[model samples]
Target chain A: MFLTVLSILGACLLIAQTTVLARMPPWLGNPDLLFLLVLFVAVKVDTFRGIILVMIYGLMMDIFSGFVPGLYPAVYLGLFLTIRYASRHVIVDEPVHLPPLAAASYLFCSGAIFLYMTIFNPGTDILWSWRDLLLQMFILAILALPSFHVLGRIAARIASNRRRIFSTAKGGNRFIS
Target chain B: MRKRSKRTRPIRQFLVISTCIVLFGVLALSFMGRKELTLPHRLIFDILGTAQSGVTGIINYVLDIRNDYIDLIGVKKENARLREEIKRHQALTVDYREALATNVRLRKLLDFKEQIPQPTITARIIGRDPSEWFKTFSIDRSSSDGVGKGMPVVTVEGVVGQILDGGNHRAKVLQAIDPNSAIEVLIQDTRTQGIIKGTGDSYRLHYVLRNNEINPGDLLITSGLGGVFPKGLPVGRVSSVVSKRRGMFLDIEVEPMVDFSKLENVIVIMKSNQLTE
Candidate 1:
């Protein structure tokens, strides 16, 4: 049930990203809300489910971005796996850990795209501006903590609800006993 | 425990191997150009694109409602003023009509069908390219309205861009100021020829001889050398020009006539036969 809700939410966010966010002022810069959601899924959800969700969202990103189809999937899935493996060794779910991870993931996704084009599609011209890059990173960093807090609260509620359902089912026979 | 572990191990291996194969397939498909979009690809675009169109419609409707309510405040005064202006313009239009009829007669004698620009279909911009470095956008015009790839899109002020990709109900346009865009142009005064390449918000006029009599505020128009854009269309105005003793060419920059940041409506030329030698 939760996964279904996430899927619907992901679809709505994807539509908003393509339509509404695309129209935002260029100087204000575009934020990757989907990436933040993926990060939340990575830290909170099961490994396999999170990886699959990230991959799907990444493909949806391609539709909005006008990029080639496979690039985001590969980058997003790679980030999910890396973050998931790192969680085993370190305390990755803490709020303090999310901003840097989100920033790094943004860089990794962008760098991989640049690297891919440089290596494979050299004929295409790519305009680069350091100012835009720095601005994007700064915006994402500022948004990270707030977005994480909001999503973390929602995830807590969902998890608690699931636990309550299971406990009630298991303890329902106490009156008969 | 041993039986369960054995069963799970092969399943995990199979899942991994299949996912790798699928990823490779997608990568290979990505390398293929946009022309190769298969049935499923088109279907996906059609479905998701409709959602984009719907969202844009809803937002535009709400904005329109707010604007209409605000506009109602001075409607009576504005209408009275416009009525007076229209009466004066209608009297002036009679003289303009006589001049226009004479101009058309003169053009017909000169075989003007090839000279006059053809009618165009207007398209509205619905979405922008999500990539920061790319200056492409999607338009509401589509193949059904005769919008085709490589067609020139323009505004009343100047050229806007060319269509890059088109679907039955939508099209993608690469803006004139994108780095990938290039046009053959000539300076109006001296007839100095150069290549106009997009450089972010402005344009760079390349290959101009260093000794040419170029200056700031010079007009650049499409030369129609490549048949991509019609001849004599306003491209940009020279914003700066620099020459060096060692180099054979001048470094020139141009300010595009159309303000892309404020672009809302554009007309796609249906057909243009105005080619020049």
Candidate 2:
């Protein structure tokens, strides 16, 4: 149920991103809500469920943007696994660490894509604008906390609802002594 | 560090093996270029494209209402200006009609062939590419509506793009401003041929020799050498011309005739043979 809800949410966010946010002024910079969702799943969800959700989001992104098929999935999964591994040793659960983490992850993914394109498709010209990159990084950092907060709340609600359903089922048991 | 249990070791191995397999699959797929849409990609397009179209419809409706309200604020001044502009255009139309008649007579005298109008379908812009790297957009029309891959999309202003891929009910357009896009164009006055390559927000006219007398504000029209776009369609106007000391070709920048960001509707010219793969 959590996966289902999150998937639907991700799809809706993608639609909005491509439709409405895409039409916004280029200078304002469209905030990557889906990237924030990926970060949330990486930090909050478990390995099995988180990886599945991340993969789904990445595939959805593949369908929407970029000519490369598997780039988003690889980048997303890499980020997820790295974060999962880093969280074990470091204190990253707090809100204070989210901005820098989001910023750094954004840079890593963008750099990875640039490297991939440069190596594989050298003929295609890719304009690397530092201004746009920094602006997007700043936007992601500012939006990271609130976007994660909302997703985290939704996840909590779903978990609590599952718990309540299980408790109610147990409470209503006629076979119990 | 604690030692792993015997049972957990196999599970860990399984996880590692699966991860490696997935990575390998991704690497293999990533290297491949754009191809026909798979079942999953098509399904996603059909589903998501419908939702995007519906949302865009609503947003456009609301925007229209907002624009109408805003227009009401300065109606009197705008109306007066429009009236004067219309009077001037009406006078210019007569001269244009006479010039057109003269051209027609000249064409008949020269035994010029009559150009048949290409079949076209209008498509509504549904969604745009989310990433800043690529300039692409999804349209409501698809293969069912005769919008096939490599169909040239245009507007009244000028050339828009070409159909990248088509699903059952939706297709994606690779905009002319995308880096991957290149169009064969000719300077209208000088007739010097060159390739116009997209540079994100604008186009760069490439391969024009330094000796070519290309100037800023010169119009560029499709040369029809590529067979993708029809001949004489307006592409852009040269915005700047710079002769660099290093290169043989003059650096030319162009401002596209079609405002891609403001485009809401486009016409796709259907061709029986797909010229581009």
lDDT of 2 at A140: 94
Give the alpha carbon lDDT tens digit for every residue of A90-133 in model 2.
87779999999999988888887787788877877655677888
lDDT of 1 by residue, B1-277 (tens): 9999998998999999999999999977886777677777889999999999999999999999999999998999999999999999998999899889756644442442344366567677887766666688889998777778888888766788898877888888989888788999999899999999888788999999887999999999999896888888889999998887788999899999888887766777766423210
DockQ (CA atoms), all models? 0.27, 0.35
Q: What is the alpha-carbon lDDT of model 1 when measured against the actual structure?
A: 0.79
Give per-residue CA lDDT, model 1, range A22-84, as digits (tens): 668878978767778888888788987887788787776665554355767777787788788
The residue-by-residue lDDT of candidate 2 on B1-277, one tens digit each, is 2455866888999999999999999967875896777777899999999999999999999999999999999999999999999999999999999889766644542332233277666678998887767788999998777678888988767788899998898999989988889999999999999999888889999999999998889999999999899999899999999999998999999999988888877778888844322
**What's the C-alpha lDDT at position B103 in model 1?**
69
Displacement of residue B97 (Cα, Å) in model 2 is 30
